[model samples]
Target chain A: MVTETQQRLDETHAAAAPVIEVRELVKVYKGGTRAVDGVSFTVAEGEFFGFLGPNGAGKTTTIRILATLLRPTSGSAKVSGIDVLAHPGEVRREVGFAMQTVAVDPLATGRENLELIGRLRRVPASELQGRIDELLVLMKLTESQKKVVGTYSGGMKRRLDLATALLHRPKVLFLDEPTEGLDPQSRNALWEELESVNRSGTTMFLTTHYMEEADRLCKRIAIVDEGKIVVEGTPAELKRTVGNDVVELQLEADSPNELERQRSGIGRMLEGFEPVAEIKSSPAGVQLYVSDAAAAIPELVRRLDGDGIRIGALTMHQPSLDDVFMRYTGKTIREEQANVHFTGWY
Target chain B: MIGVAYETFLLGRRAFLRWARVPGNWISTLFFPLIQLVLFSQLFKDIIQLPGFKESSYLAYLAPGQIVFAVFLGVSWVGINLLMDYHNGYLDKLRVTPINRISILFGEMVPLFVTCAMMAAVILVTSLALGASLVTGIPGALGILALSGLFGIAWAGTSFVPALITKNEQAAGSLSLLFFPLAFMSTAFVPVERMPGWLQVVNNWNPISYVIEAQRALMSTGFDAGLIGKALLAMAILFIVTQAATIWAFRRLTA
Candidate 1:
């Protein structure tokens, strides 16, 4: 009975709806620790959004709230347009959560672990095996699918855990520090897999302290600190706000006076250069903030050639997410040591 | 309710597989009781000749108690499985699913019936191999296994309540020891008549004694509905009390 115009309007409206929406969400732990404080953000459907912060920065707390694993103390969170608190059951159907800790049965085979979760998620019985086989191949776990997870490597366990989350083809996937414990190679591999998953049209909401991870994966990121987000933007936009790329010239100076002389000499020579925004003296040599360090470096070397400023080394690097984080939070992310407690039961 | 049952069935299969794949789980559970069955039956061979004993051999009387002992051993640390899930974040993973939350608890509980019954059967078969008689035969053996499984479900609360309250596996494990004295005081090893008068009075109210007595009746005598009914009544009361507390504790922990 619907007209063509009305059907088109409905489709447009559905496409415009945000998959994840939050407003002033707060979660205070039992001892009055405000884990998530007044956080709000929205993710459009099929977007790869991330929360970037150090440990205990409420990233996990916020993701858990959105995942409906922990109830927030105040404010609202909606996943796929359903309120998380009012109807968690419905919200759960639209989302998959890959927790920081890998949760898989060690005694069960990889296929068994996936089947158990797939059944619980109500994946159709008829298509379950075919779906599992597809995922197993995608995850590169086809050979190990029949082996118990206890015998699998750490990276294999993580992939299997992720595959379990992906079994039901949720509209959104919430990954909390998905690569926290992976080796560099495994982390890169997981990042590629995550990108492919997002390409298949699942919105990804990831939380991590890894700057490279956020920079590479997220279309937009919110930098969180002390239970609140300090800034939010696309990765490139955030880095742009931190200003120019840095080009450091390690001058070959025999004494402090020579170093200071060469620093001022380089600064005076580059004072009128169009690419140079600011110049400063560093302990080793001169540091220049330039619009594009790679393009400006040859001219800079030419300008300093007649001044007896012998450059020991020249290094030009773009401002990274770490720079953006430092600009906003006034601190770098410090990797904390993991504490192990002996419960004596095992 | 149907949803809960369906979810419980799915999760219970995982729980059962987890137990069956680990040979240590059943082996350690049966080792203590099997050793006790073989050692106690021979050590107390002449004790069956005592005035209060009506059995032909000590092995026949010892078999039922050992069967219950196997069931008890099977469940003593059962709560640790749930605690492991909590620590490892499997519970959180399950919570994120759309299934009923209580299904996680029931998933754990439902599997105990099969495991406890199988563990009891091992001791039962072992006892028979060692020359114990089942006077009522196969039906009686099935009855004894049914009682053992129910007792396992009822008694698991002793481990679960502490585990949930303390959130500590060691505390749950050590707290189960506090119930061992109750088993010893029951007519597990000695008849009520051989105990002191005050002990005999306590045995009348001891739920373990009722279960052991019902199982003993099945093993040594014909089907005694009176004894079976008393055992069922005792276990029903114990099941109601423990399961109610367990459900409350589970709700609190999950909440």
Candidate 2:
């Protein structure tokens, strides 16, 4: 007797049911440092979820808890509906993890590494050889399959690391900064490969501080800071919250007194504009958040000239994931990365 | 149980393969004990002339002790690769797998057992070639190797402690210093009766003294059930305690 709309809603909910859930998870290390504090989130089935954070922002700690590598101080987590704490072995069977650190044996050959992992994961003997060959070919590692890992380049090692995680065909794959140190070309190649992996219907939970990685790959991202999630939404939705575009204006004055006066002078001129949402002035320049930067900049230039303020340069920027991060976290990702004081060992 | 056993075998094979790949490690593990055996035999040949020295040749007397020494040295290096695995994050990779955690411990032990057994055979053969003979022949030599392998297992358990706690290669390597004092204080170089009064008491208290005496008995005399049984009991206690501590430390490190 359900209506058509209600039936559609039920179907949508069933298809996107949570595969990973964290409830008030906290991890306090020895001596009183809290690495993860009261964090909670859910990653739905087949969702490409990204956890974006700077170093020491508790991203690794949260990932470790879910991977069953470390026990949480309190609260609960479930992976694929199995309690991470109570049934860790069952969860391990369903989840594959590639840590920030590459985990292959340097002296072992590429094929040896994959075969060892396959045996450890208990892939059937009949299928293990074919699976190993398939992964080697898929990763383009077949040519170097017999070479020692120590001789392999960084990018090659990373590919083998991914190959190991992909063995046994895990339902959920957890990758922690998989492309942190790769070159642009290698990063792009890995991105394409990961996209194909996601296309095959496996849920992916990736953690990275790279803005473009999250923006391009993840369907939804959670920006975490100081052990807490600052914002969570799709890239477009989060950028929409910031505004349509940003106008960066560089204006110079003859003296410090004139510069101070010119700053307030521009603020006043832009204040009455209907498209302008907010205006912030800094020593470097003035930034205006607006609905349409193209239409507002022409009007802004006319008013500046009428007010006798000199305009040095002007540029318009579309709202990006970086802008969304700055709007919520009050600092750029690079600045936050520099300011981080790492306290606990992972 | 069979799955765990099979996994342990595979893990063991992997460890041996790692050893095979490194030629420098190959030469050191193979020749280091032989070099030590030859040097100690020549240097301490006069020890047999001392009072209370019952054995005919110092090399003969020192051979069993050297076999035990080879086992100790080989087993101590077991944690070196484990610490390497820790530094490079392989341990975390293994933790997330469905493989039995005990295999991680047992797997490393396999290579150590092979190394110890190899060294045991080499030192025994070297001793025999250098005019040291076994009273009970090949069977007695095999018994000495088997018993020393058991002690190697016990010592290997103790070696894992430093590796798990420190997770540093140098710190784990320093733990080998523990065997130095045990080696010098026990009845390894000279018979306990010839040792100083205070040292004789210390040697009596040292577990290595029982292991040496048991191996010496099997090597010089025929089978002595009492001596071997006593050594077995002492090793059994050490194995139980050290292995328990290792398991606890491993759980804590991962936890």
Candidate 3:
């Protein structure tokens, strides 16, 4: 028996607002080094947002600021519509932080750690044990719950950490490199668990170096570099921004002198392909970005053959999060990761 | 407010559970100062024979000093625990919780205070067993132990600065070593008047000297309000300064 005007008002009010909002956030260290340089983004409710970056790219700093663990030098952040700086205690109640490093007490059992955090978070004592039991089953740590954290494996500990973060069923969860050092199986298991959590209508903000994790798990991603976000979009949209397919062609050079000439010729030759949108070249090979890789390949080989350029090797792939990262950061994520030197207590 | 008290209670329990789970941690904090007590009293037994010494039993004179040493040593270990928490990301995790920050610090400290009290109680009993009677009786001895616990808290406040600044257990270890020099420089082993004039001037400036003298006064004569007030003032000043430093350290750490 609701009137049309009343129904419209209800619908408007029911629309989901962003669970996380950050604007022009800056964090400068003591020596005037900006760890987070005016970074900004928003995470809509129930969206699994991924932050991809190299080490020291300020991803962790931004996460820390948003989590209310570290204060920002400038700008503003809001969690669950509450101003983080002004009401951090309120913000904390709405968000859960699982740090990059494992934070469980080594002397405490898995159940004890969760129980302690659950109590600190003010989960009702009546519901606390049931929630812990549910989390233990969800994290697949039921059998190991009695053992102290020191006895748990790396994967088990990470699961326990995630369980701790989820104990209160926070509206927004911030996970900083949640599976950094886990093996493939453990990483996959954790990812699956996280996916189920996100599906339960929790807003997720995670920072990770793993492309597959971001690709498979995150619905949207922001690539941060040198303390600022270089690009942000849905996974499909971001991959589309850099073209759908990557065509890597190694030019056959008869001698060392011809290598440079052949690379440039191959690069110029691929530029005229109708389906190709961008071309990049290095000493090892030439890469072409194409809208339709299957349509461009036959035409691509024809041009190379007609130009008298030998195709030493040719491979094509659907553009991956890796290509999107490389295109924005000017280096492969792996290369950047290798060059990163971690110093101090981090 | 209730939430903070609840969190503090849980966190304090966690700290005690750490001691219970690892008996070695409690053992070391408790027994290390006991060894120092026995060694110093036996070695400095002849110092009381010097002129101007009022106590017939040197152990009685040294008992208060040993209690101060034990409490200080036990309390300073809080720094090591805090440093470990920092390195392991436990503090950062805790910071994200809704619990009050002051609760985080005070909860961690409650167990250390307990350790200090236990160390003092054991040392007091040992001194009594060695025939060192308190002129003011058991009540006076309890007062002395309570004062030692206060001093332990002040000293622990100072220790937090180094722990947060260096963020290493080795730095905490080095700071503990520094405490030994401070202990020896004071009248812990001898009366301030018996020391050289320059050393006595330095001891007068030492907060530990006030604590030792306060405890000694309680044990040797009776409850002297003047001595206790002076000791309390010295400890208050030290507590204010060191607690300020510890708060600054917490700021730098979170910053």
Candidate 4:
């Protein structure tokens, strides 16, 4: 009783099969800090997967585990189906990682850096120079190819580092905040480069706290907090899960009296509305997670007018990645970034 | 392993390119030793008088010692670069590359070895300008330089232990005090025979003395196979300690 629907389902499942699978991964530092605790996810083949987490949320620990740099305290991971623990060397061969840190030799030129990586990857001697040339151009490092890395700007060094990782052309590439501190131009260029890389048939696993970048680049994302996958799905899927719309009302003033009054005033307005799934307020503003933002906004404004409570302004928009993170983790990405991250470490 | 070796060579090229891009670094590496030689030779010649039998040999003794000092000072700077790479996000990049992780450590060592060799050559040249020829013939003299390069390797190798202890450059540089005393306690400046009994015993065990004595043996008497053997053996022992220390440090931290 074979059916066409069943065949289609099988083909879809095959398309979504993960190239990277990490299950129950745990990493406990010496001081009893469980950096990565029981996190699990699968990065599907050809998917641009994002690991979105704040600093100290275990993104680096998880990345380190997959890269075979730091062994997990428990659990197992497979990269390109190779067991990370049992076959680190094999795992290394199939995965290219551009770590958060820059490790390029300052004494060497960009060309030399690429050539060295080419040779290390055992690219045939005849093909080495061509690979170097291609990577140099791709990174926009051709102008500085013969110049030492010490003289290169931060963006240039980062591009060169990325170029070295790309030189080997592995099945999957791990980029940890690939454009964290770059200028807007450089960051956009790197994003464009990554798009082309994905188009070339290599899966990219990225970790970043930049919500917009994740929304722009990743087909799927795992929002991580406290060393766990709080939720995972496409940027659109996760945003959709936050219901349909976000309702915001700015507080007219910074006074405590105004803040408390505004909080309870908005609270009363949406109390009995079922489609208004959630009402959350903070110092900056009040937000309503609603099923239909446009329909509720006129009604909401009427209540404020009837009560004689001032509405600074009200606007409704689709749920953003930040709202999704807040819905799942009870804190915004900026809060998490501020807590453990160096203000300039990006 | 061959792949690892090639990566190390390639990475060394990168480090070299960094220096070439900044020509000031090359000038400093070439000239730093000569400045130290002239400064220290004049300072010691005036200040602390050691019982070295004759003032005539003071400059001779200072010459070999400066070469050792210059090599160590120049080579140990490699650790700072390694630590900088870590801080600047470069070391982390290398960690995940398909290139052997050992290449990261070995790559640092190669440029270090080259830098030490060059500084030694500079000091040797300056010694020649001061009318100092190895009382040992030219062939014997080159051997001295070769052995001194090993001392530099051992010194630079030993630095990895501190690197593993702390990723902070300031902390690593501060800890270099331990290595400085080992050089001073050696007979690099004066023969152990002139020391008091207890100090002489300590001097005998100091590894740098073996290196200095090995060079002194060659400079004082050319092509003595037995002395060269003992010196080489001693240098080998220190080299082993350093190499082992570096490998163990890297394995312990990285694993």
Best TM-score among the predictions, by candidate number:
2
Clashes of 2: 0
Please, what are the lDDT tens digits per residue for candidate 3 over residues A136-182? Answer: 99999999999989999999999999999998999999999999999
| Residue range A1-346, candidate 1, lDDT tens digits | 5798899998997678799999999888876778789999999999999999888788888888899877889999889989999999999999999999999999999999999999999899999999999999888999999999999998999999999999999999999999989999999999999999999999999999899999999999999987899999999999888689977788899999888888888878877899988776655786667897787778878888977889999888888887677667756675321322122111
Q: What DockQ does model 3 achieve?
A: 0.84
DockQ, in order, for the candidates? 0.79, 0.83, 0.84, 0.58
In candidate 2 chain A, what residue range of length 10 has the lowest lDDT sum? Answer: A337-346
Rank candidates by TM-score, best first: 2, 1, 4, 3
The residue-level lDDT of candidate 3 at B209 comes to: 91
Candidate 4 local Cα displacement, residue B87, angstroms = 3.2
Any runs in candidate 2 off by more than 4 Å, and if so which?
A1-16, A249-269, A273-275, A281-286, A298-315, A339-346, B29-32
Candidate 4's DockQ = 0.58
lDDT of each candidate versus the true structure: 0.89, 0.84, 0.84, 0.76
Off by over 4 Å in 3: A1-16, A28-34, A242-244, A250-260, A269-277, A290-314, A328-330, A339-346, B1-4, B30-32, B129-131, B134-141, B166-176, B217-226
- What shift in Å separates residue B91 of candidate 2 from its native position after superposition? 1.1
lDDT of 4 by residue, A96-131 (tens): 888776667667667877776677678889988888
Chain A of candidate 3 gets a TM-score of: 0.86
Q: TM-score of chain B, per candidate?
A: 0.98, 0.92, 0.92, 0.85
What TM-score do all the candidates reach, one by one? 0.88, 0.90, 0.87, 0.87
- Model 1 scores a TM of 0.88
